[model samples]
Target: MMASNPAILPGDVAREIIAPESYAAWDPLLDTFDHLRDTMPVAKVVAEDDVFEPFWLITRYDDVMRISKDNKTFLNNPKPVVFATREATEFARAATGSNMLVDSLVVFDAPIHPKYRKLTQDWFMPRNLKLIEGEIRALADKLVQAMIDAGPDVDFVKHVAAPMPLHVIMQILGIPEEDEPRMLMLTQQMFGGQDADLSGSGMENMTPEQVLELVSGAVKNFEEYFAGIAAERRANPTDDVASVIANATVDGEPLPDRDMAGYYIIMAAAGHDTTSATMSGAMLALARDPEQFARVQADRSLLPGLVEEAIRWTTAVQHFMRTAAQDVEIGGQQIKKGDWLMLNYVAANHDPAQFEQARSFDASRSPNRHMAFGAGAHQCLGLHLARLQIRILFEALLDRIDSVELAGDPVRSSSTFVGGLKTLPLRFASQ
Candidate 1:
């Protein structure tokens, strides 16, 4: 049963929730979420111009966690897993006959999702990741040395954070070093297309359809490029994750072409970007607070906490959409069947109810149950890898750098999806 009248967000606020530009101006967006959490935590967001579909915005920590953990009640399919404009939704449906352009683990439900996820599940586990520890550390050292050589002033995001995880994940996928730039560009266009600086495609001036077309083109390029890699791995199987996916069997049969491509795309794009974002955020936080930076540097044991706090503080993947399977009561409101919901991770991670001094980054914060990597079945598969990458990179950074401070204003990516500091200028001295 529905309520006589569901709460609706004001037009300006609703627009801010969906506007990509709002995310770049980070503090203001958090202020918006703070206001929403106090007044209308679960209000409905209807686009003023009807450009996008209407959905309930879940702003509280408990509500977002509940929805994230209950994948069945909150279905990922039959709707776009990520929010899409009406035009973009139709464009995806007409092209792929699905609500999303990329049909990866995030877009799957039930039986299929678990089956697909198990293919490389062990490989991402901490124990299995130990096999690549040296490789990751070496990459970290090289990047950190490059940062030192380029110091006392450098763009940490450009020189260190961005390339460390990108190189590591590329190696895990058996991608040659030469082809990494192409992969990076495609990933930016796919996830950061809303930002002109990231996409470099002038997407801010483009219509939704035009922006989507650019994203689709990036997907096509990825498929074509990975298609050849898949062929090579199939004929000559190796120990890499790419080979595992290429030769994986769901039900005693090889995976379909689309599913295989989807698997590769997710690994190639997500495996790196989210980790990079967290790394950049951690550095930015350390730069801003020299005491915290010195504390972690002097006490190596605090590295893990720093990594975890960074993930929570940055919350790179801001929000994800989930559709209701049936009518239900949540947050003192009735959610009807098939209603779309936005699990705003940014809000959940920053909720005062869940975290003390939610706005501030505290490495020592215990019981840190953040939804940055999400939860339940669709929780990020590479979470352990992400943690490992950040820990090792920061370890190298702390060992090499004696002190660090901000050189200029940091710039966040204008992406409502996966985003972090795109530019982190810092002045540092070598130990």
Candidate 2:
């Protein structure tokens, strides 16, 4: 049988890196990806199971940067930012008559993508976020107080990290405070499908097909909810992100239902989780290395670097998929047309050639243009908002938290995508 196609090529290493269980097995993946970055650089993932596609796993700093920046050749349209499980892909195709990928800015390529992004582009600009700084700061302060009230030993994820970003993003979207819980639940189900603890679907006995149904159900709920919001906003306009989506028009036409809802969902899901993960990682880093915490506490100027470092270190939004439109060569490997490739941000961020001490957490590393927020055209739209939130929160945190240390072994969400610690138990010397 043609020698069984030689198992395609990059072997068990690639498989381990993307494996869902490996999400909790953090250090092993770091080590494996580090080896691949150093050795293979741009390696084709040898596909063993039929769950994932056989494609290039660009591990090096240069290769990832190139692919991420060159959005045209490696298009995000059709199949964007993730290699879906075969079942999910088929489900989406059958249900929506499209790929399982959601069509947001991250999922769209040029031309149409730019126009769609332009709708709320100004709203997310630094100037706009600055206008709402006071509101966000007040929200952050309230969350800090809530954390303080929770007392000596608290699950940081449950008390602070999770709620803080959810509140901020919800406020931005003009979502009622009461609806925050619903938003959180839907987001968890969407991105946390791999982690039963976070998915809340009791997925242990469920097969992949069952989990996909759970995920599909969640997406349907989001779509229905956003549709109602879109109608309400159009009828009675408001100043929040929801209103913007409702009134948003592309080339003189109202945005398609899916894109509008996808935009809202992306902001809701991505807005909180990435920020929460980074915050969790930052707190974890500070607890581990008190010296760094003290230094940041002393000089607040280090807040920006701390945020950047945390994003790179955590890499919450792990990988994005791209489809090669034509034959292309990257890192000396020929990428055939229509092949799906994963831009492994985790590996790229830790490439030793790009970062001097890529493994160690360093807040002083200047010129740190890590691909944590991604790069080029599709770089995170909420990057400025995420940065501002982290910067300000740390400023508030360092000022209030007299001391922070881990109270127990932290637990990470078991997911290949959007994974982070679900529970970061910590003992803090409250201010």
Candidate 3:
């Protein structure tokens, strides 16, 4: 076993690396990643109290991209795909008889993954997306008008960023308009448990037990909610994604109850949250730099660059854990069979080796081939939809808003995963 000392991230640094609060403060966390890439990019993160077993942290862009593309060697199954503290894993075992409380596409490996993904794969493709463009534009128009009517001082997260993706996803899922709030609330509890504002638990410093309890409840809510939706869709089939999952089959059999629920949860949660994060991050960048904002406003052709850059800048869905299926070497370190590894997207996205002036937000950055949507088959399924939503919303914003700037301090979500700005206050002038 590797000794837990100065070699890898120190005990304190390892703990902070996984902590929610540390993620809230972006720069300090980047400094830690910068240090890791320079000294030990593939070092083990050892726990002092043994609350969790050690896992290698992959910091470099090349290493992360390699693991992401090669799903066979670095598989998602046989380990918790997301980082979980020892206490949380143990609690999950007791509660659900599994290391993870929820299982979804994010946790599945090949054969099974390919089959399940094929169910709704075509629905999210660019050709299908064109059919919904009018609806999206209409939503954008209504939302942008609402923002204009909302006065000069507006919380961008509340008024614009959060709702655009949420509504788009909900419409695609065949969920009723009235149920949108419930869906958003449930998602917040699931992904935002560490944030006091998002979790609604009324406690900021929650215990491991409390966090697990809240997460479990949210999962239960999502499962119960989607079960009914699944049943409805199966009975009265529609062209929506929920119908596809409800009627999907693998090996000539319907998906098991748990797998079906997992499908719905991933579709419902990851479907909207990550896009919202990128949208908010993009707005934050424009609000801070008026020149780029004016540039994009003058030349509408820069919209695609703006969207791509924001996706890279935020890199929501930060890290996904992959267990080594066999002995392999990466970044000058020998990794053994069955060892767990973290593909740190945030670190890779910011690596100077990959991105020039990695800190500066470039709306017109070229060759931006970022791993923000991940790589290979496991890449984010909603990527095209995310890009479309951001583009359409910004088009609407450019049409209505003459100028914009930050009204106050913007705050970020306290989560190491599925994170971006949660509170972005902006002052805008109507065109």
* Ranked candidates (lDDT, high to low): 1, 3, 2
| True-structure Cα RMSD, model 3 | 1.9
* Model 2: per-residue Cα lDDT over 1-431, one tens digit each: 12222223455676686778887878888888887766667667755766666777888889999988887888887563676767778888887777863567777777988898888889899998999899878877887787888867888888888998899999888888999999999999989988888888889889988998888888889889889989999999999989999998888899999888889888888999989988898889899998998998998888888999998988998888889989888776777789888888888888888888888898988879899988888989999998888887887788788888999999988877787889999889877
Which residue pairs in candidate 1 collide? none
Please give, for residues 239-313, the per-residue lDDT of candidate 3 as tens digits: 899899999889999999999999989988899999999999999999999999999999999999999999999
Q: Each candidate's TM vs. the true structure?
A: 0.98, 0.96, 0.97
Clashes of 1: 0
Better of 1 and 3 by TM-score: 1
Q: lDDT: which candidate is best? A: 1
Candidate 2 has what TM-score?
A: 0.96
* Model 1 residue 8 lDDT score: 98
Q: Which ten-residue region of model 1 has the weakest summed lDDT?
A: 1-10
lDDT of each: 0.92, 0.84, 0.90
User: Candidate 2 regions off by >4 Å?
Assistant: 1-11
Question: Who is ahead in TM-score, 2 or 3?
Answer: 3
State how far residue 429 of model 1 sits from its true place (Å). 0.7
